[model samples]
Each structure stands twice: as structure tokens, then as C-alpha cells.
Target chain A: MSENLPFLVIAAPLFGALVASLVGWARPRYCYAIAMVSLAAGLTAAIALLVKVSGTVSGYEYRLGGWPPPIGIQHWVDPLSALILVVITAVAFLAVMSARANLQLELPGKERFVYPLMLLMVTGLSGMTLTGDAFNLYVLLEITSLSSYALVAIGRGRAAASCLNYIIMGTIGASFYLLGVGYLYLKTGSLNMIDLRQIMIAGDMHGSQTVITGFILITVGFWIKMGLYPLHGWLPNAYSFAPHAASNLMAPLMTKVSVYVSLRMMLSVFTPDFLAVHALWAQTALLVATIAIIAGSLIAYSQTDVKKLLCYLVVAEVGYMAGGMWLMNRAGITGTIYHIAADAFMTCCLFLGASGLIASTGSRHIRSFRGATRRMPWTFAAFLVGGLSMIGVPPTCGFFSKWFLIQGAIEGGAWHFVAALIFSSLINALIFFRIIELAYFKDVEHEDDVSHPPQVQRNEAPWGIRIPLFITSVVIVLLGVFSPRVINWIERFVDSVGVT
Target chain B: MSDVLTFIISRFNYWIYIVLMMIGLYAMIAKRNYVKKFIGMSIFQTAIILFYVSTGVKSGATIPILEHGHDIGHAAAAINPDHYANPLPHVLMLTAIVVGVATLGVALAVVQKVHDQYETIEEPEILFKLGQE
Candidate 1:
């Protein structure tokens, strides 16, 4: 059981998806229960893996079918990947738990298709996180992307159009990644990441133009996939137009997983030494990330829709994670790994809260939030916690991650990044305050008109919605409160890899 | 001039892959019609498959299967790697082909939905309709 824990993390969801799709056609009611049980099982396996791995500095490896490395497939779970696995499963489980009411409201009678695709997407994400082969990662990335495209298209208005755009961009991004892996395979003759690294080191291929080209291709591919600034054209629309249930899951996990892939390539496959040799490239990447932070925030400030605003902020958060990783020091990478989990929960929290509010009020506009505290105070409170976390307020996970990122930027002498982080945080505060003011204060114009009386009846989302939002908020606080231990765990992985 | 020609001829497959990929990318980015965009997507994926499959080719190498598989214990030491073409890349591309087909199917289905919604598959016209609504 211990040895199969890593595989079980993925298989649970895969099995659930299969069962949901098969059993759903005849009995649609069972799909939700099946999805919940499967995802819960996966979450359990992931937590067990994390607990087991917590005791050791060196993480565990599980080979498929008892075949050894460099030949058969491998699932490598170090402290970092294990932590991310837990984050993925936990966020998915919460999102799905909340998804019942949201999906029924948004995509009625489609639970059968939606549940299976959601499970498959989670399976792909877990596989991408756990797999040790470069090519295997690409296949799993497609599985995740393909299911998400289908899920996004399940929405009503203009959904297929946005999904089409997402498909084109996603294909290009994935193809570029495939081409890069091809280049690496040609140069090193090995697809297994550990084997490829050993071969490159033994052959001293760091200086080879082919290897450099492969590195550039892979980095740019991940950049497109992760929506880093200039290449983020397909993100805001695809996410905002997606069905609320799908967006609740995809909005948090997709880009963050892509960022993790980039970090994995840099840390293990390409090695930090290769990056050090190309300091100019690293600086260029940092500069781009800084611009992304400022641009995402400034654009987010102009949004009228609450969901779209959160989508744009996600763009900025991607910049935070990407920029933190490029800082290349111990603190920077630890912050990045920590932020991935932190940002996942906070984003999930915000999206779930937004969707619940949207459902309760029957509107997606910012004005719908007027006197929201009186209308649905519990959901509003969850959104406020998420908003505060986004603003880097203390005792939430967001603040600790930002602190580490700032320390890393200062140590790395990248003042631009530090400035961008501060600037983005201020913008986040302004945006959230604007919403809060609308929610807390009475609409003055409406008070003057006295025609409508500003209906502020107490209407909250179902317990299905409230419970997940509540748990996610608590997790954010818990992550922040126990960040020292989390960072300490991340540091052990960083130290083992000799990244600094 | 002869040396340059030799260089071009030696890596002709890579050059073709790059050219095909660029053509596909341009269509996917610049074309207005949904069908054309998917056509380009298919071409783009084919180019990648070509790249991977081409990497597996070796001169004077035969298919990887052995005639006496049942007697592999006696023949295991006698196998020469250079005598057999690499099968891994080909196997990987089989998976890639399946993924490509799946992506193409999904893209076309979405395009069908777009057509049904707007009565047009031209991107610009669809956008115009969306704007008016």
C-alpha cells in the first residue's frame, strides 16, 4: 500500500472518471457521489504520501510494473512534488464539492459529462506532477488540456468560441513543448529525465547549441502554456467564459501546474548550472515577469465583472510564481514552491466564492455586489478573506509567499521585481476595497431614487457551496500560520537539489 | 558553395520540418476561417510527428524485431544496437498521433458549435456577431 501510494493518487481519479462516465448515462445522480468518493480517495492517498515523505530528506520513487529506471516508466515524488500533489488533490476535491450547486445552476443535466472530464483533468494534472519522463509529461499535459477544453466548451454563451481560441493556443503551446522534447531526445538519446541529465553531464553537452536550443524551446513552450504576460492572450477570455463549475477548477490549477513543469525542467533536467551560464537569459525572463505583474494588475483594475477581475489577477499571480523561480536563489525557489500551494488555495477560494455569489444574486456584474454583506454575508466573508490574502495581508497564505518572494528579489538585486510585487499588492488592495465599499455601503443613487428600495434579502448559497469555501479559507490561514514548517520542507528539497 | 549544399542536403529533413511547422503556425494564427485553422493545426501536429519519426531513422538499420525471439537468451549478447533502428521514437509518436487526432476531433466539434451558434465559421464574422450581441 505504501509503495503504491503515488500511483494510487492518479489511479483513483482515473477510475472515478471511468465509472462516472459509464454509470452516469443510466443514473445521472450517481456521478456526483462517484466523483466525490474518487477525489476524496485521491486526496487521502496524496496526504498519506506527504506524511510518509515528510520524515525523509530524500523522497521516494515508484516504478511502474516493477521495471527499473532508464527503461520503464517512473513516478518520482520528492518533498516538492508530494506537496504539490496534495495541493492539487485538495483543491480539486474542494472545487468539486462546491461544484454540485454551481454546475446545476450553470450546466444543468450535464453532470455526467462534466464529472468525468473534471476527473480526467485532475488525473492528468496528478500524472504530470508525478511522472519522471519528459515525454510522459507532455502526453499528460495534453490529457489535462484536452479535457479542460471540453469542459470549458460546456458553458452556454460564447463558450465554444472561447474554447476554440483556447484550443488553438493550447495546441501551439503543447506542440512547442513536444518539439523541445524531440530536440532533447535527439541530443541526449534519453527521454527519462534523470537519465537525460546524467547523459548531458557525462557528455558535457551544456555548451552544445542543440541542447541550448532545446532549453530555449522548452522554456518558451512553458511560458506560453503558463500565460506569462505577452503570451497571455488566450487566458482571461477562456477562463471568464468557461462554465463556473469548470472555471472553479481550471482557473486555479492549469497555469500553476505549467509553472511547476517549467521549474522541474530548470531544476532537474537542465540544471541550475546551465541557467547560471546563461545569466543574460535569466535576467531577461525576470524583466518579462516584472512587466507581467504590472500589466496584469493594471488590466485587472479596469474590469467590471467580478469573475473577470479574478481571472486577470491570476495572470499577475502567475508572474509572481514565475518571477520567484527565476530569482534562482534558495529563498526564491522556496517561495515559488510555497506560493504554488498558497496561490492554488487562494485562487480556488476566490473563484468558488465568486461563483457562489454569482449564483445567489443571479448576476456576474460588480454592481450585483451592492450591500452584499446583508444579502449573503457568509459567502462575502469568504471572498473578503480571499481578497485580503490576495492583498498580502498577514495570517493568510498570500502574505508569507509574498514576503519570501520579496526577500528573494532583494537578495538577487532585482529591484524591479520587488517594486512590481509591491505595486501589484497595492492594486489588489484597491480593487478589493472598491468591491467592499460597494458591498458594505448602501447604493447612494438607489437610496435617492427610492424606487426599488434596494432589495437586500438574506440569500446565501447552499451548504454545498459554503462548506468548501469555508474549508478553503481555513486552509489559507493554516498555510500562512504554519508557513515556517512548509518553507522548511521546501528548503530541504531545494537543498537536496543543490539549487543555490 | 559545394560545402553549403552538403550542409543543406545533410539536414534536409529538419529543414522541411521547420518549414512545414512555420506554414502551419501562420495559418493557425492568420487564417480567418475555422476550418482552415484546424487544417493548420493538423498540419502543425503532423510536422511534429515527422520531426520525431525522422529522428529514429538510421542508415543500414533494419526493423527492431528479432526473428528468433523465443531464443533470446542465446541471442541476447549478439544483438548489435547499430544493426536495429531505434523504435522508441516511433512508439512515442504513435501516442502523439493519437493525441493529435483527439485534439483535431475536439477542435472540429467546437467549430461545429461555433457554426451553429453564429451561422458562420469565419472568425472575424463571428467576432462581429459577438460584438453586436
Candidate 2:
């Protein structure tokens, strides 16, 4: 079971997706059960893998069909990869479980197709996280992109157009990534990331024009996919317009997966030594990350729609991760890794809560949230917890990630990043607090009745929606309490790589 | 001057690739029609295939298939036996081609959806209507 864990973790969801797609034709309602069961199994395997790999000197590398590295496709499950796999599968499990009711409401007749496509998207994401071959990453990236396009367009009317823009931008990003791989293959003779790392170190090709070109192309491609600043034009509308369940799942996972890809490439594929030896590459990364952080926060502050605001905040959160990676220290890289999970949970909580709000009142505008707390106290309290996490307040997962980042900045003597992180946190707090105040304090006059209604009402979101939101909120708090242990695990893993 | 010219000619495939890639990129950025932009994207992706294939070409090379009389020891040796072109790039390009086609299919579906909603594929007109909404 342990030997087959890597394949099982990825293959379970993929096999389930295929079965669901085919079997769903006979009984549509069964698709939800199939997807949830598959994801639950995958989640169990991932957690097992994480425990098995924790505090180990070496990582697990499983080659397909018994072929060796550079020839056969391999799945590398280092501590970092194991951690990300857990995050992806865990969030996906919760999202699919919560999505059943929302899918019935939003997708209605199309619920069958939604379940299979959602499962397929999970398969693609897990494949991307688990694979070590560059070309395999591209294939998995496409699978995810194709399913996401379909999922986004599942909404009526304007969602189709937004999905179209997302496809276009996403295609460009993937193409650029392919081109970079092409350049890399031309220069060095391998596509396995570990082999490529060895070749890069053995040869003095760090500052060569070809290697630099490949680096730029790959970085730009990932930047676009991660929705960094100027390339983030497609995110806000796409998230805002997609059906509630789709937004909830995608808003938390997609860009974070892309960020993980970028970090893997920078640290594992291109090694810190390569970046350190190349002045232009390091400076360019630092510059772009700074710009993305500032720009994403400012734009997020200006959004009026709840989902759109969260979408822009995703953009800013990507910047924080990207900035930490560019810092290129143990503290910075560990923060980026921890933030991936922290941000995933925090974003999940917020989106799930927002979905509940949307279910209660079919409106997504921030102004429509006036007096929601009185009507939906549990959901609102969950939202408040999510908002505090987003603001990086103490006793939440978000704060510890920021703490590591600020400490990394200080160690690097880069006060500019420290300032940018502080500014972004301030803006996040202001924006979310404004919504909290509206939901709690504002009065709503009932026009349907002769008298003013009481501050509290009997209305609350359904149990299905509230359960997931509550679970994620509790996870965020637990993650905060256990931050030191998690950070230690990540640091040990980073040190084992022997890079820093 | 002669060395520079030699270098340019040696990398002629990359130069043509660059030219084709630039054309595709310009059209993707400048065109308003969605289908046309998608076509441009396909062209851009295909150009990389050409660039990659070109890079694998040796000055005087045969195909990378194993032959009985070739006396190559293993698959790696067969890759460039008698100065044959590298097969790694070819294998990678195969995957890229499939991804390109998948992207095109999704793009076409999205275009169909856009047509259904706006009743037009023109960017400016769609923007105007969306603004009005």
C-alpha cells in the first residue's frame, strides 16, 4: 500500500472521473457520490504520504512501469510536494462535498456533467502536483485548463465570455511554458526536473542567453497563470461570474497551484545557485513581485462585489508567495510554502461563506450584504473568521505566514518588501472590515411589512453550505495554533534539499 | 562579420520561428475577432514546434530510428547514431501538439458561447453591450 501510494493518490481521482463521466449517463445523482468517494480516498492516501515523508532525509520517487529516471515518468513526493498534495486533495474533498447542494441549485439539470468535470479538474491538479517530468506538467496543466474552461462557462450568459478570456490567456501562458521547455531541451538533453537541475549545475550555463530566455519565458508563463498584476485581467470577472460552487473551488485552488508550479521551477529546476549567479534574473523577479503585490492590493481595495474583491485578493496573495520565493532564503521559501496552504484554507472559508450568503439572498454585491449578520449569524461569524485570517490577524494561519515573510525580509535587508507586506495587510483589513461592518451594524427596513422587523431574523443558510464554511474556519484557527510545528516541518524539508 | 553571418545561417530555423511567432503574437494582441485571435494563438504554438524541431537538427544527420546494420548499442545511442537528429525534442513536440489542439477546441467552444450570448464576435461591439449592461 505504501509503495503504491503515489500512483493511488493521483490515479484514484482520474479513474473516478472516467467512471463518473461514463456511468453518470445512467444515473445522474450517482455522480456526486462517486466524486466525493474518490476524492475522500485520494485525500486519505495524500495524508498517509505526508505522514510517511515527514522529517525524512530523502524523498520518495516512484517511476512508472519500473523504468528509471530521465526515461520513465516519475512522481516525486518530497515533503513540500506531499504538503501541497495534501492541501489540494483536502480542499478538493471539502469543496466537492459542499458542492452537491450548490450544484443542484445552480446547475440544476446539468449537475451530472458538473460532478465529472469537477473530478477531472481535481485529477489534473493532482497530476500536476505529483509529476516530475516537464512535459507531463504541461499535459496536466492542459487537463486542468480544459476542465476549468468548461466549469466556468457552466454559468449562464456572461460567464461564457469571461471563460473565453480565461482560455485565451491560459493558452498563451501554457504555450510560453512549452517554448521555455523547448529552449531548455535544446540546451540540456533532459525534461526530468532533477536531471535538468544536475545538468544546469554541471555546466556553466547559468547566464547564457539561451538559459536566460528559457527562464524568462517560463517565469512569464507562470506569472500569467498565477494572475500576477498586469496579467490578471481575466481573474476578477471570471470568479465573479462563475456559478457559486465553481467560484468557491476554483478561486482557492487554481492560482495557488500555479504558484506552486512557479516555486518548484525556481527552487528545484533552476536551483537557487543559478538565480544567485545571475544578477539580471534575480533583480527582475524582485521587481515584478513587488509591483504585483502593490498593484493587486490597491485594485482589490476598489472592488464592490464580494467575489470580485476576493478574486483581487487572490492576485495579491500570489504576490506575497512570489515575493517570498524571490527572496530565496529558507525563511522566505518556507513562508511561501506555508502560505500556499494557509491562503488556500482562508480563501476557501471566505468563498464558502460568500456562497452561503448568495444562496440566502441571490445577490453578490457588497451593498446587498447589509444586516446579513443578524439574519445569518453562523455564516456571518464564519465570514468574520475568514476576514480576520485574510487580514493576517493573530491566532490565524494568515498571521504566521506574514510573520515568516516579514522576518525573511528583515534578514535579507529588504525593507521595501516588509513595507509592501504591511501595506497590503492594512488594505486587506480595511476592505474586509468595511464589509463586516455593513453586515453587522446596518439597518434593513422591511418594505413588505407594516412595521420594522427585529434585528435578528429566522433566516440562515442551509446546513450543507454552513458545514463546509465552519470546517474551513476551524481549520484556519487550528493551522495557526500549530504554525510552529508546520513551519519546522517545512524548514526541515527545505534544509534536506541542501540548497540554503 | 563573416562569423556573425555564419552563426545566423546556422540558426536559420530559429530566425524563421521567431518571425512566425512574432506575426502570431502581433495578431493575437491586435486583432479584435475572437476566432482570429485563436488562430493566431495556434500559429504561435505551432511556431514553437518548428523551433524545437529545428534545434534538434544536426548539420548532417539521418533519422533517429534504430537500424539492424547501424551497430548502435542502445536507444540512447540510436538517437544520434551516424549523427542523427535528437529524438527528445520530437517526443516533447508530440505532447505540445496535443495540448495545442485541446486548447483550440476549448477556445472554439468558448467562441460559440460568446456568439450565442452577444450575437456578435466583434470585440468593440461586445464591450459596448457589456458596458451598457
Highest lDDT among the candidates is held by which one?
Answer: 1
Clashing pairs in 2: none
lDDT of 1 by residue, A1-500 (tens): 88899999999999999999999999998999999999999999999999999877689789989999888999999998999999999999999998899888888899999999999999999999999999999999999999999998988998888889899989999998999999999999898999999999999999999999998988999999999999999999999999988999999999999999899999989889888999999799999999999999999999999888999999999999989999999989999999999999999999999998888888999888887888888999998899999999999999999999999999999999999999999999999999999988755247566566666568897788899999999999999999999998999989988887
Q: lDDT (0-100) at residue A115 of candidate 1?
A: 98
What CAPRI class is candidate 2?
A: medium
Regions more than 4 Å wrong, model 2: A446-456, B1-4, B68-80
Best by TM-score: 1
Q: For candidate 1, lDDT tens digit of each residue in B1-133? A: 9999999999999999999999999999899999999999999999999999888889999999998778786768888989998999999999999999999999999999888899999999999999998
Worst 10 residues of 2 chain A by lDDT: A443-452
Q: Candidate 2 on A73-143: residue-level lDDT in tens?
A: 99998988898999999889877777877876787878777888888899899888989999889889999
Q: What is candidate 2's lDDT per residue for B13-122, written digit by digit as tens?
A: 98999999988898788999989988998999899889888877787888876567556555454353557787878877897888888888888988888898899987
TM-score of 2: 0.96
Clashes of each: 0, 0
